[model samples]
Structure formats: structure tokens, C-alpha cells
Target: MGGSRHVATSSTHPGDLHIPGSHRFYCTAPCLSWRGGVGMRGSVPPPLIPVSPSSLLQPEPLLLAPSGTSRPAGSHRALRGSLERESFKPSSQPEEPKHNRRQPSPCPRSVVEAAKAHPTFGELFQFATPVLMWDQHFSPETWNRLKERHVPYGWQGLSHAAVSSTLRLLNASANRHLFDRRRFPGGCVRCAVVGNGGILNGSRQGEAIDAHDLVFRLNGAVIRGFEEDVGTKISFYGFTVNTMKNSLIAYEEYGFTQIPQAEDLKYIFIPSDVRDYIMLRSAIQGSPVPEGSDKGDEPRKYFGPEASAEKFKLLHPDFLHYLTARFLRSELLNMQYGHLYMPSTGALMLLTALHTCDQVSAYGFITANYEQFSDHYYEVEKKPLVFYANHDMLLEAELWRSLHQAGIMELYQRFQLENALHSAITPQPKRLAPGQDKWEESLAWRRNGLN
Candidate 1:
């Protein structure tokens, strides 16, 4: 009689309570809170019937049998009305963008310049002689057996098929570095792998030269007043014995009396002759230059004790296959190079850089309007981009354009970037030496497909 609670009927209102079959107990004060444990001692009452609004109010004490089972101290299911109304569902996740790829560490201008003061083994390895090989891929055994193992990492002992696939991936990844694709967040890093082409002289790209992250030059490419057209920075310089000599002799009038001096510019040697190998080996051992009749006077000075020839990086053979398989199609490969067989030197240099640099932007290369410039920057006359028996220029151009379209490279057009760098202008007829004319004739014959 002291404290028994009862509910009479069930109602939709929050304050109205029900206890089924007992006497009516209308809740008129406020909402009620059920707390503490309720023991299940007696049976529950019958189901309650809802009262209509017209029914009269009753105040009878309803019997409230503690029907709730007593759960263990921590095992109670405490369900709040507010919590029960909220629906639970998993949320959708966002997709990551493709541009989030590997990033290369940026080498600052100051650091790059600082590296120039000390000439490493690369600088000392002055001789670049071309090493020619047939289409036959080298076996892993063959590479391991070589006197000096020059293959890049991860390329040793791979089967031809495996090597083919791996190089394809590498080439694909490298091509991604050549453009402004979403795969490369760093945007395009244009590199002008400038050859000693006389064609660049009157092309009018002097002042409007393309802006790129790096520039590679070879041999005797003199960029004095044409700095605007060719940019002032010399990032990478490549050389071979014959090519470097040719550059010096050919471009001497183009302000190339001495090699372009840069604090951080790297000198890359292209081995094209057997003598170059001997000279380099001697230089590495700090020995005197070999005694050959053709050897220059006082060759010992070229390979002094300070020379470090072994540090120079050589191109991996797999890299050549990667290039040949992708760009140099079979038809172009069969294109002969005079009495000997080889790809264009400029093409080879640029291709090597494509694989080496993390990002590449090309400037001062042949374009659709290649007819607009002299054969070389220091040319006395405007010369057509003459095809030679020594190399295939048209095929190279086609490859460049294809790579550009595939987002693999950036080719600076002759007229497009003229105002960006220092350049010169002239109009002259095409000319060639007596011995070189034969090469042009052979080039024309190849163009006509004589064989």
C-alpha cells in the first residue's frame, strides 16, 4: 500500500503509460524514467487496450508486477528511444587520383652549380667511342662473362622475354615523365638535347626558346647570343671521340671555341670507337695515353693522375632494345647507315636521356618545319635537314612526333619558341662537302628504297 505503481492503458503520447489488465493510471505530471533492476517474480498482466479521447479519466491503482527479467549487472540492454530512431549504414569512400605517383627529389640550382667545380671521373673520361652491336640480344651469361659488367641494376640474367617485358614497363614509366599527363604531377620538364645541327641557325627560336627543367648538349654546340633561343643552362653534355671532334671543327664559327663551361653540367661519354675504350682504361689506371700514330701530341695530359674514368655511366644494352622495340620500328631499323650500321647519334643521345632523366622536355630538335634552318647553328648558309647515309633523320622526326602525341616527350617547334632564348637569323642555300655529298646521295637512295 505504500508504493505500488500501475499503468492502465497504452497510448501513443510519451507521458501516457500502460500495464495491461490492471486498474487505470493516467500520467498527467511528466515523462517517467524506469531505473534499476526489476525482478521477475509474478506473471505479467494481459495486453492493454488503448482508451479513446472521449473516455473518462480514472485514478485507480494499477498492479505493477515487476515482469522485466533481472539481467546480470553488465548485461542489460539499455535502449534509449532517441538512439533507436537513428538508422545505421556504411558510408562510401573516395577514390584516389592517378596523379599520385612517385616523385623525384629536386636538385636545387645552387647545389647543381656547386657540383661543377670538381671534375669527376666522367669529366676525365674524355674519349667517347661508339660500340656497335648487332640485333642479337646479349645473354645473361655473356654479360656476366664480360671483362667489365656495365648492365644496369635488375637487368642481369633475365631471359629475353622477361627482359623485354621489364624494359617495356620501364619505358612506359619513363614516357610518363615526358608530358603533362595526370600520371606525372610535376608537369612537363622539357629538355633540349641539342645536337650540333646547322639547321637551328635561322629557325628563329633564338629569343623565344622553350623553358625546360634541363638542357643536354653535345660536342661543339655554342650558344652565345642565342642563349634566349637555346636557354642559358647547360645541364647534361654528351660526347664521343668523333662527335666531339666534329662539333669543335664544324661549329668553331658559332662561338664554340671552347666547351660550354657550367658549374654542374655533367659530361656523358658515348663510346663509338675501340681506341676510346683503351684510352679510358688507361685514364682510369692513371697511365699514359696509348702509343698510336693517330694519337694526338702529348696525350698524357688528357689522362693525368687525377682522372677518374670509371665513374662515367654507360648506357645499358637493354635500354637500346627498349628504344628499338618502341620507337625504331622494324622498317626504320633496316635503314642502312653508310658502310656501317648504326642509329642516328642525336637520336641515340636523346633516347638515352629519355630513360635517364626523371622528367624530360625537348627543345632545339627537328620539327615539322625543319626546312627552315641551316644544317648547323654555326653554318655559313641555311641548309636543309639533309638525310645522310650515316643516320636516319626523317625516322627520328617521326618518332619524336609519335612520342609527343603519346605524351612521351615535348618537342619544341622551330618557330614556336624563338623569342625565349638568344638566336640568330640568316637566309642561305644548302651546301655540303665533297665527301659528305655521297652520304646525302645515299640518303636519297635509301629514301627511295633502292634495295
Candidate 2:
């Protein structure tokens, strides 16, 4: 299998580097315009603290379940037994009839009211409705819109037959479990979006994070030793096919031997590549990956034996586009990184929770004080967080801070919660100016072979 690669070249301008393979560049020249020719001559942001090459984690060799080996029957029974134990047991006091139970409202009134009060919040609601999932059959328009704006690596020349086959498989699956009032009894659903930032270390927020009705975790979510701080419950695991595979290879030493598995847990597949669609189909059907980079791979190894269509959800490509255009739009887009640019998995999962849940608390997310924490809580030694060209961490940090001040969500800011909140709301017209420098530094690190 041939994988895609990005090659960078130095340009005449300082901090300007060209990625020929992806046709993207890092523009540092003051006169250069970005994103619709907007002048970016303001002060450049500070450089990201770089980690030595030896400090960076290396991914292990790719491994999959042997082609013909089936998931052991004992594991299935164990999962089934665990589900039965966790199943909701109704109260003895009289149960509401199925018809009488409160059904989920088509549009949540609280969310609407909140949006009306905050223009930024309202804009997000308009762009991406929380109630719907971007499945192949249920959202053709969304799927098409996504295909036009987002190009997954190695999928530029994907055949029409391949697309159709994947969609056909997805169309046959069941719908996702959106916010249902019937399940919660009360109208509100609380959620926690947990990023794997090292700030979570010693935060002792496990009980708080797990208390929410649902919890969303992504990429290298290590829980074994850090349970007291990061929580043990994982209701949803969100990732692109690339991130999931990369995490397994890179963070396997950190205990992410396989994707999170539970009878009721759902996997949100961000369709960054055709491989995601192919893998999702194989997982649901209990078959080996039919073709592509993951050909002959068994899905049951990641998701247990009884994996079903109900356990998988695909993010609509349109929704991702909307997120980038409206909220996390970074200068990187004009640099030609649009094809590779997508919100960090943490950002996507948090936004999903915000749109769907009545109340949300974010744990281990990026804040102004991110430098104080390690790159990830699971690291044996403290490692400085490194910024990469593919993501706009500062933009995300600003958004999270703003959301917290607006009473939209509670971002766990560790010891600097109050300070972070204050700075988020403070008017700083020159904030982005200083932040732009970080991207340049990130590019420098990549050029130095530190990716």
C-alpha cells in the first residue's frame, strides 16, 4: 500500500515554507494576504515551545488481528453480562407508558433560546443541527457538500464505485442515538468532553467528568492510572481513521492498545478518508476490510465481537466544513492546508456535545496556560505541548475561553480557571497578532523533522 507524504521547501520569505505535495505554504511576509486577501501584517504570535526529537513518541508497527481469527466467544459473553448489569432498571413506583413518556423535541428550545442570546452560539446552531447524524443515506446533501470541501488523503481519485459501495453499506445501518428526553427522564442531558491534555494530571476531576450523562473521549485517552483525574467512563469515542490508526501506533505504550469498547459505547467516525467508510462497513458487517490501506484488517479486534451498526456514527462532512468556516477558521486554510485541515478531534467532539447536550463541562482542553501542562496526561515524564501546522490550537483556545465566559460550557482550566476566564472575555484586538508566530514556529519544527 502506498501512503501519501508531504514535502516542504524553503521560500524566499522568512518563515515561508512550501509543502509541494499538498500545495500549501506558511506565509510570514507582512505584505502577503491570507483568506480572501485579508492583510496579515499585524504582530506575529509567539513561538510554540519545541520538544527535542528524542522526547517525541514514535508509533509502533501497524498490527491487526490475524485474518481468520474470530473474537473469542467469552469476550462477547463478558460484554453482554456487563451491559445487563449497567442496564437502566426502572423504579418500582409506577412506570410511564411508552406513548406517555416525553419524546425528544425536534428542536431543543433551550438551545434555541441560548443561540438567540449569543450570536456566535446561534450561528453554530444554524450551521450544524445537533439532532442529526451525517450518515450516507440520511444526509446526501450534507455528504455531497462535504465531498466538495474536504479531500481525504489518498482519496482524490477514489472511484465512484467505491463511494457508492460505502454509502450503500452505511445507508443500511441504523440511526444514531441523539439526545432523547425519554432516556434521561428529565429534559436536560449533561455531557463532558475530555481531551487528553496533560493539564488533567492531578486535576482529580474523574467524578466530575463521569457524572455527566455522556462523556466524549478522543485520541490517546489513557484511563487506567489516571482514572481519578480523567474518569473511567467513555460513552463516545470520536476520531478520524488517520488519528485512530496513528494513536494506536504512537501511543500504544500509553495503553491505547485498541479503541475503547463497551456494549453501549459509540464510535464517531470523522470521514477524513475513504478508509474510514471502508473500516466502518467492515466493523458493522464483521468482515475483513475489503480493500485499500487497511485491506484484510479485522474490525472485531478494535471493536468487540458483537459490534453493530448502532455502535458507529459518521460525522457529516458538511458539518465539519461548517465548523471550519464559522468557528475554527484558521489562516492555515489560505496556506493551502484546507485539504488536510480539520478541527482537532477534541474540538469536534466538544462542539458535538455542546450542540446536543443541555449543559457541558470540558476537561483537559487547551487553555492559555497549556504550557504548564504536559502534552498528554499519560506521559511518564512531563512533555511540552507541541503545535503542528494541521491545527489552530490558539483559535480553539480563544473559542473555548469565550464559550466559558458566555456561560455556554465550563472549561476546566486547572489552577488558572479564573485567570483564563478573565482573559477570554477581555478585548484583545492584537491577540491573533502574537498567535500567528506560533504557527511559524510549528512549521519550523516540522521542517526540522520533528513531526
TM match of model 2 to true structure: 0.67
- Candidate 1: residue 223 lDDT (0-100): 77
Which candidate wins on lDDT?
Answer: 2
Candidate 2, residues 35-104, lDDT tens digits: the string is: 2223234332222222111111112111112223332333221332222111111111111123422234
lDDT of 1 by residue, 1-451 (tens): 2345544322211222345433322221111222121211222333322211110001111111122322223211121111221211111111112342333425332212222232221121111111222123245553453313122212333344433322232222222232233533564344557765654555565444445556677666677776655656676666654455444444556676665554445445444443333344454445654543224423235323353432233344434333333333222122121112234556777876554444445555665556656656655656544443223455566556545544445566544355324335544222222222222222233233222
Each model's lDDT comes to: 0.39, 0.58
Q: Each candidate: how many clashes?
A: 45, 4
Candidate 1 Cα RMSD (Å)? 37.8
Output the lDDT of residue 242, model 2. 55
